[model samples]
Target: MRDYDEITAFLGEWGPYQKSVFFFLSLSVFPNGFCGLSIVFVGDIPEHRCFIPGNLNLSEAWMNRTIPLEQDKDKLQYSKCRRYRLDVIKNLSEIFPDPDSVNISEVGQEPCLDGWVYSKEQYISTIVSEWDLVCNNEWKGPFAMSIFFIGVLTGSFISGQLSDRFGRKLILYGTMGVQSVFSVLQIFSPNWELFCLLNFFVGLGQISNYVAAFVLGSELLGKSTRAIFGILGVCISFAIGYMTLPFVAYFIRNWRILLFTLSLSGLIYIPMWWFVPESPRWLLVKGKAKEAEAIFRHIAKKNGVTPPEVFFTDLELEDLKAKSKQSSTIIDLFKSPNIRAITIVNFLLWMIITSIYNGLSLNTSNLHGDDYLNCFFAGAIEVPAYIASWIFIQRFPRRLSLTGILFLGGVVFFFIQLIPSNLSIIATVLVMIGKFAVSCALAMVYVYTVELYPTIVRNMGIGTSTMASRLGSIISPYIFYLGIYYEFLPFILIGCVLILAASLVLLLPETINIPLPEMIDQMQKFKFISRRDHMNLDPLYTHAATEEDNTVTQKTEEI
Candidate 1:
């Protein structure tokens, strides 16, 4: 029985067919990048103060007195949510020779009954300004972001099943349309409730489209190119989209216009339906041998190669059919002791990585700099991180690299707290460095987790782990809320969680250059040394009896 890789060998790896598929599939990831994080700009809270009614009737001194003064850090500013009683202030101004002589501190204050006056220096309009999502209603901002992640969680859980039942291409295009339409609808939302409701569906479609395209690209591309496209291509595309976001947000400024622009960008992908092909592997698994053969022939012709009349034999088809029938469930992930340990560790690592990644991203406004520059810096940092990840995954042990980067990120976060409040620039730089480390770990874990699970349950394992990550994202927005109690509490919590996750990573086996397992029994028998022990071993005996025994056992189980 021949494998798909053997068949793909004849079609060529870096030819026009593979390149086109790679380009289109990766293009889909761009819009997902910004749409997911657009809330950072759309919900931004600008400098504001209470609007004093009938202020024109008063003199300059009395007008200033209408709003009480408060100390923020070293600077004094007008109170944001409250103003003194206008009638009392007017009466005092008339009775007293000088308005400044009256003690403003003794005056009573009330909530801004006439609405708030927002600063237009940065944003012309935002959801925060549009709906007055400030002061007592500040919690709504993070809650809207949380609602979107809840949709992402829903989408991640359902996308795989839908792709399996339907096809990758169908689900990919369908979800893309769903994401696009609902995102546009967000601009028309009259209230915050409706906006959040639309955002929920947008999240559902966003992640579904992303995962479908990712899986489709992996299946369609040749083995030699698969790892590159899977690991680096999609990620770099996402970074480009993310970097583009700040520039767009900076220029547009209005929340509705920004969303409309981002949502409309999805239309560019509509033409992809004509260009992108369904996964040939999925077709073959579903017994559509002729369809799969047609796609292979199309790929060959595009690459200027000719295929024999009998490209695939009946015996090979039967073998593939039998292989596809051997399915696994979520329960299989924890049915065995070794596999269970791997599952639990990967789940927790994903949670921590996701929390730190998003927690730092959503908290960009907290940094002392332009929100656009900070966000751009955050996205730009990931580009090099992805490149570094590609090199590290090939050279270093996956387990140690994952643990080391995560630990480094945590240590950076710990030091961020020690920076003086006045040195916000230094703090911002430290946060970006920490973001870089976390980004590297995030890229490594995706490839590492796939390599860790057996082929039988690879999709299930990744799906389950992705769900865990979404759960972490849901909590991420709330993590910043901790600042209400203690200014540095969010960083301290993330740092502690990341460090604890890094320690757990040490328990998992490394997968660098190791043959991927095909079954539970194979995974159970696999053995690995700690990176320190492996480094100490003699190169001549690196593949000695103990290692050979495990390799032989894996092969025997496959047979």
Candidate 2:
């Protein structure tokens, strides 16, 4: 087998033990994965809050607005859409400014309320009429989630660029500082619009920590260790998000306090900035000769190895750049089809995985499973999924494993629909398995995605894939909110969507034995396969290579 690229030379220089600590330190980013789940876990949520208009008396308003929205045809549908938005925006009240809170009209578009955020939910557009939120008529929860992920989607890509252009350390520290400010606003927010606005900034600011932490972990471990380490890092984040969230929700019951406290705690991780090394690859990518040199020396010092100063010179970086050893951009992904295909498939998988993970996990509390044991049961499922991935990911083909798990997830969900409501425990267990499979699929996607494309655009591939996942995460809230009333339909549809996603995978290429190509040029040899076996790429290459050798032997015999 070919050795890992010398570009990964930083690993040999750092050795094994230091690798462990760096990997451990990287765990600090666990919070980023949990942030959305954290902010949404308010007690006031699930049980939608009654944010009655001050002008309308509570009992009278319930008679005119609440009951009417439920029973009347045209009015009920409009009111349900109105309530869903209000439900989401009011949840944003955790961060919105008081007195200045966004009124109903502002949520949809008109901004009837002076400070209200105009809601723009799209996923639940079909059944938004059934639910009820005591907030204004304009609140659009899915749209609100879209706004938050707008921050995440835009922020994640931007931070990735800035990290490559500047340095991961500086970007990480800067984002943490800004995020701290935004989190504080959760306490003071009087209006829903401002809350959405603040979440945008927070999403933008917090993603750097995620980018830098993963980069740091990959740099610390050897290439062989990369998959397991990265997957575990992801599992750690989800498990923590699942486990700790209920406590935070139970204690802080008030989403605002929970948000403020968590945001403020982010600053505590900032000091680790002193110990976290700048990424040697990033430094090499940017041509920062001296900075790269110093960081390399520190890593060598930690590993008890001698530093090579000769490689840190200006001429060396420029040479590395010429040799095609530097990093690249997202636009580079579309420069070739191999990267493009993997990227498209990976993006779709991410979208489905994130939506399923968020849709199921975030709302587990809503399933009448909110007690101590039930909550424990919920948090406990993610770990095994991680264990299962570690076993099957390498042993089985990506096509088989991915499709099987997702298809099974959907099937399980479908079965849950068949079980009666009285079978709560059995149904919850089955749904937990579904959630577990979805989370595992998400983690595996992270590992599989990295190797599917060429190196020039690896980060771009992952970033774009993540951008799609954020789209899924954004879409999930509406899916769950809409399904609350049409309970079986949502579960059944989520299953069907996941099944559709699994089918998409069946149509893509499998990367198991096909060595990860370092550039688009290497893909030329593998492109002529029949479409039926598109994903059956590994064996085709071996067979073709043997046939070529035999042809060469025939010419020799003729001569």
Candidate 3:
């Protein structure tokens, strides 16, 4: 029976219909770029110290000494949490009217009971400043970010199931609405607790819409266009959206105003539903052939082409229906040794990639130099990385390409710690390089993982791998929080993990020039074989040159 692509060949790739689907669907992902990482600026910690009220009649020098100097990282800096006792300073100020003559070194330090005074030079307000999520409460900032990823973890488990059952376009738009509405509601959150709660919903909707759009594009676009649409179309659009964040955030420093502005932009995408149709392939799979036919005709009309009088033959419809009913549970993933080994490798690879990618992205604020430029460059480098990955996947061996990139990223991160603190720009450049390597590695891993799994359990494999990624992302913020303990702790940790990830990639068989494994027994487990040898082992595979040669020899002898 003909597959959906073979049957729809008449529609042509890159026709007017394909172009519109690519454009609108890619645009749908634009908000996700910023939505996922908005916490970078939203929760930024500005320069702050314990507030010293103006009522203190102390001299300027004494007032400057209010925040006691202490060891932070490598140097002595004004303490963020502790201050010289103001009452003691007031008494000393009275005894010695000459502030220069007074010795207040031993005045004793206390916690900031008077709240904090945040520097407004960079940002007028952020979540950190608005609610004093600094010093002792600094953990809350990263915790909030983790809470968002936890919601993403929750969404990863259920969004795909919902999309499979309810259809792609429905879940796509439904989640988009969830993300935008919750973002707006977050602006009115009166306290940190409510804001964090809203963040969970925002994270849930964010990943749901992104994944739905991805699957929708994969199904709706034709074969020739799907590759580029997946790489350049969707990925670059997201990068463009990410690049826009720093600019928007640069202008609007206040967290509330930033959410308001970004939320309204998301709301504008709601009207896109009028033009975008549900995926025809999904409809056909669900036994709604009539509806799928109507959508095909609509697409043909939009592309200015004529559709065949009959869209789906009865046999083709039955094939699709049968395909839909064939299901594999998660247990199948662990049932076979080869399948289990491949699944385990993919899980680690995905977790490593996701955690480092998000860790570097969120840690951009901690990098030396302007926070906005660091973030902007971090996003900008990915566009090229994604494009390079698309090219690499087409030409390079999958295993080598992934290993090389991951290793390079790990080395780049390691080099960051060696750079002197004064050379902030150099360090930032290395971080960008690290980001580029991981972004490229991530793109390759997605394609490589798809090829490694058999068709029956492919969805389950990818879904489980995605869940691992969410867990990685969930832990990423906490890893970034380690920077507080030592400035380069996170980098050193990420570098070690990425290096381990690179080493692990050597265990997976290369998929380049190799046909996808269609059954559990066909997978390579942990070793590679000659293409002919690999194909000859799978009874279901007939595309091998050896098979064709054997057929020719038999036919000639018979003749």
Per-candidate TM equals 0.92, 0.75, 0.93
Worst 10 residues of 1 by lDDT: 533-542
How many backbone clashes does every candidate have? 0, 23, 0
Q: Give me the candidate number with maximum lDDT.
A: 1
Instruction: Please write out the lDDT profile of model 2 over residues 62-133, one tens digit for every residue.
Output: 223321124431233333222324344435454543423434334432222322222322111111222322
Give the poorly placed runs of model 1, Cα more than 4 Å off: 524-549, 552-559
Q: Across residues 1-559, which tens digit of lDDT does each residue of candidate 1 receive?
A: 7778887788878998888889989889999887878998999899998987675477777887788888775588888988998778878888875786888789898888888999999999999999999888989999998999999999999999999989999999999999999999999999999999999999999999999999999999887877789768898889889999999998999999999999888987988988888888999889898998888888889899987789678888788788777677898777655677688888898988997798888988778988999999999999999998999998998888888998998898889889987899999998999999999999999999888887778899999999999999898888988987877888898889989988988878767666776655445222342222222132211233478656655554443
1-559: candidate 3 lDDT, tens digit per residue = 8777887888888888788888999999999887678999999999998999889877887788777888876699988899998899888877877666866677888999999999999998898999999888999998998999988988889999999999999999999999999999999998899999999999999988888988899999987777788889888988998998999999998889999888876865777797788988788878999998888888888888889998777877778878878677888777645566778888999999998898888988888888898889989999999999999988998899999999999999899889887887898889899999999998889888888887767878888899999999988888878876787888899899999999989988777766565666555546442323333243323334477455543442332
Winner by TM-score: 3
Position 240, candidate 2: lDDT: 66
Write the candidate numbers in order of decreasing TM-score: 3, 1, 2
RMSD (CA, Å), candidate 2 to true, equals: 10.3
Q: Would you list the rank order by lDDT, best first? A: 1, 3, 2
- lDDT on C-alpha atoms for all candidate structures: 0.85, 0.61, 0.85
